[model samples]
Target: MAYKSLLTLASSAEGVAAAVDAAARVALASDAHLDALALGVDRSQIGYSYVGSGAVILQIAMERAEEEARLNGKALKDALAAQGPDLRFSLDSAVAQLGALTDLVSSRARYADLVVLPKPYGKGSGPEAEAVIEAAMFEGQAPVLVVPERGFAAGAAPRRVVLAWNQSREALVAARRALPFLKAAEQVVITIVDPPAHGPERSDPGGMLCQLLVRHGVKAEVAVLARTLPRISDVLARQCQDLDADLLVMGAYGHSRFREAILGGATRNMLESAQVPLFLAH
Candidate 1:
C-alpha cells in the first residue's frame, strides 16, 4: 500500500534537517501527510529522584524541561517552513524525559505508515535517538527509515532501491514492510551473500523472493555476491555504493538484541556504515 501517513523525529542540530528532509522527500513522493516531532530531552527525569530536592528545584526542573521542548519545537517549525512549505505537514514538540519517552513515541508511531528516524543507529548517537528508534521499531511495529545525519545526495531519489536478502523471518518482515517502496521504485535489486549449499536455497538464494516480488510488480533482479569482506555490512555498503542505491532495505536484529549487541551483528554494523537512507524492520 502507498504510504499515506509518515512521522519523523528531530531533536539535535545535526539531525534536524536530515530527518525533516527524508520525511519530506518520502511524503512528496507518496503524497503523504507528514508529522514532524521535535524532541527535547529532559535530563532531570533521568538524573534525580527529587526526594531530597526542594520545591524551588523542582520548579526549576520543570521549567527547564519546558524550555527545551519549546526551543526544539521552534527549530522544527523553522525547518518545516523553510523546506516543506508546500507539503502537507504538522509540527509538534515533546518534552522527552528518559523513562517516559518510549511510551510517548510508540503511541504516536502506532498510527503512522512509516516512521523516519534522524540518525543512523550505532555508537556516538544520543540516548534520545536510541529510545525513539526502539519505540518505533519494537513497540510501535512500524518500518523505520533512518536518514543521513548530514543530508541526502544532491540529486538522488529512492527510485534506486536495494533489499538485502537472507531468507530469515526478519528479512521477510523487512521486505514486506518495504513493499510499497519496492513497487514504486524504478529499480529494485535483491542482493544475497553466500548461501548454504545444502538447504532449500541451494540453487538460488534470492530467486524465490524475486519470484514473489515479481507477482507484486516489483520486477527485482538478484545479485549474488561473495563475501570478500569480513563484515557483511561492509559488503552490503559496498554493493550499495557500486549500484548507487538511494535506499537500502534490510532487517534489524535478526538474532536476540543482546546477542547482536555483544557480537557486533549485521544490524549494528550496517547502522554504522550505511551511505544511503536505510529502511529497516525488527
Candidate 2:
C-alpha cells in the first residue's frame, strides 16, 4: 500500500521544521500529505487525584505543564508560519492525568499513515518524556520515525537504509511498511544475525528475501552476521555504522498474550538500545 500521509509529532519549532522536512521528502516522492503535529502537555485534568499531598503537588504541576505546553505550541506555530504556506501544520496538546499519554497518542495514530517522534528532552530522565516515547513505540499503530535529540537539518533525507530481517511476520510487515522509503533510498541492506539452528535448512530465508527485493527493483544486498563475540544487537549496530546506514527497518519481535513463555530474542535486544532510527512492525 502507498503511504499517503505522514504525521510528525514535534515539541520544538526546530524539531517541527525538521519533522516537516523529513515527512515532506516522503510526501514529495510519493505525493503524500505531510502532517506536522505539535505535541503539548495538557493541564486541565492534572489535579484530579485525591490522594494526600498529591493534590497540592498535582495542582502546581498542572500549572507548570500548561505553561510549557502553551509555550511550545506558540514556538512551533511561529516556526511553521515562518516557513510560509508550503507546509500543513496542526497543534495538539494532551493532559497527562492517570497515565493517559499512550491512549492519546494511540488515538492520533489511527488517523496517520506514519508517525514521527523526537527524542526525549532534558537529561532524558523526565517521567513524562519517557512515557511519551514508550507510548509512541508500543501503542502507536503506524510506523514511527524517530529524530535524534540534537535534531536534523532541512532536506536531510535518509540515503542508506538497514533492514533487520528475522523472517517473522513483524519483520515482513516492517519491510512492506518501509517500501515507499526503500524505493526512494540509494541503498538498502538486509541484515540478519544468529539464525536459529532448526529453521528451514535448504531454503535460506535471507537469500529469498534479497531475491524478493531484487524482483521489486530495489538496490539491495544481504549480509548474515556470524554470532561471534559481540551480542546480536551490537552486531547489528556495528554493521549499521559500518554501512553508514541512516535508517533501520526491522520486525518488533514479541510473543502473543496467550503464549507468555514464548518471546523473540532479537526483539528484546533491539528494544534495550538501538543506534539508529528503527522502522518496526509487530
Candidate 1 overall lDDT versus native:
0.80
lDDT of 2 by residue, 1-282 (tens): 567776665544444544455555555555566665545554345356656767677778777666666766676566556654655556565445436767876677767787765544433224444455446556776777655543432343567988988777788878877786677678899988877778862357488878878788778888877877456667887887899788878776455522421443554455446556666666
Model 1 residue 4 lDDT?
Answer: 88
RMSD of 1: 2.5
Clashing pairs for model 1 are none
Off by over 4 Å in 1: 45-51, 54-61, 120-124, 153-157
In the range 52-105, model 1's lDDT, one tens digit per residue, is 665666577668767777876876787777764668998888775677888888
TM-scores, one per candidate:
0.90, 0.78
Please report how far candidate 2 places residue 95 from its true position, in Å: 2.4
The lDDT values for all models are 0.80, 0.64
RMSD of each: 2.5, 4.4
| Model 2 steric clash pairs | 42-94, 42-95
Cα deviation at 152, candidate 1, in Å, is 3.7
In angstroms, the error of model 1 at 71 is 2.5
